[model samples]
Target: MRRVKLSDQIAEDLRRWIVRENLGPKDRLPNERALQDHYGCSRGTMREALKALEVEGLLIMHSGPNGGPEVQQTSAEIASRQLRQFLHFQKLDFKHVYELRRSMEVALALNVVDRLTAEHLTALEDNIRLCENANNEQERELARQAEVEFHDILAEASDNPILVFICQFLNGLIRDLVDYRAGSLQEHEAFGARNVAYHKEILAAFKARDRDAVAKAMDEHMCCAETSMQQLDAAFYSDLLSRR
Candidate 1:
């Protein structure tokens, strides 16, 4: 069995302590010496623990006379990055990703349709507009990214925090796959046009608060998207093999 590092144990303890004491963002951890004394740890070990927590985004380190560790508000970006590192050695691929999307995206859309605010609706519309208004390759790439951002807006309308985080992480993976795919401007333009149409349809369903329509549109869009992404994946591998 692998042994856990002392710093890791201490970091986890600090995390639990923060939660138990109801410490939130901007809450300062006790000074290093105080923490060292409390944990019966040497100064160097305490410093290592604090540094580890800082790297995990659990704490922010301060400097000088008023320097110590402070709690920082964690974000989905941190969570997604951590997930990526953990899954890097695994054989997780686009098909596995879309399989998860197929099961969850439709339900999430239906759940959030009634909860979308006017601002959320406007953002969704803007996402589609970005795709349509793109006049160059760079702008079209941005527009393609906006296609995924459309679902992110809907994810935020969810009252469930876990659902929001999982969806954000999955979308992050999708964006990475999007970047890795090998395709020409023609293929990209075709995908972008499909994205615009789907987003427009989904946005209309959301505005009407039509749960059925939202579910149907989201499922269809994700299904079609999975096919597009798979084609891109095939092209990417084919190019790599040809080069070899």
Candidate 2:
């Protein structure tokens, strides 16, 4: 096994301390001297560890009086950025993204059906309307954003942190890719209409709280999107492959 850095180990120990103590955001951590003494490490090592956690958005270090590293809420934006960086290195094509979404999104919809709140359902309906009302190319692009927003809401409503992060990251990646090939997306007029219809069906399923129907609706929506995009823009897959 690869050797772990001392600072990394120290950082993890501090994280455990936070959890064990049920630390909340803005809760002041122990002073540098105390942390160094408790961990039996030098000030430099302790500081390095604190710095590591700070970079992860788990703590904020302050210098003056009433200052030390304070616990901070972990933000999804931080996690999303890291995941995006990893996907960039992986050089995933659009097909890879769609395939992954096809495999998992149905499960997400099914899981979230029972969990959908009044607010979540309302937001989803509004996004569907936004997509339906998109008239010009510019409006269509905004509609596409609203469509992604709908998926983002679904992911958040799932209330499973892992699912939430994966879905949001994938949705973000797809949006970026679509924006990269905006011309191709614009060429697919039928796609926008079909997408709105599919979302309407999915929304209806969600409103009914029917898990099986929701999963089926989601599966069909993904299949239609993949087929329509591939057929309308013959170079779509090739463009994505070249990016890889």
Question: TM-score for each prediction?
Answer: 0.92, 0.83
Q: Point to the candidate with the largest lDDT.
A: 1
Q: Local error of candidate 2 at 191, Å?
A: 1.7
For model 1, name the residue pairs that clash.
none
Q: How far is candidate 1 from the true structure (C-alpha RMSD, Å)?
A: 1.9
lDDT of each: 0.83, 0.82
Q: What TM-score should be assigned to candidate 1?
A: 0.92
Per-residue CA lDDT of model 1 for 1-244, tens digit only, reads 9999888899999989999999999999988888999999899999999998888788999988888999987767987988877875787667889999876888779878789998988888877787788724667667667778888988989998888888888888887766656352347777888888888998888888888888888899999999888787777777779999
Worst ten in a row by lDDT for model 2: 228-237
RMSD of each: 1.9, 3.1
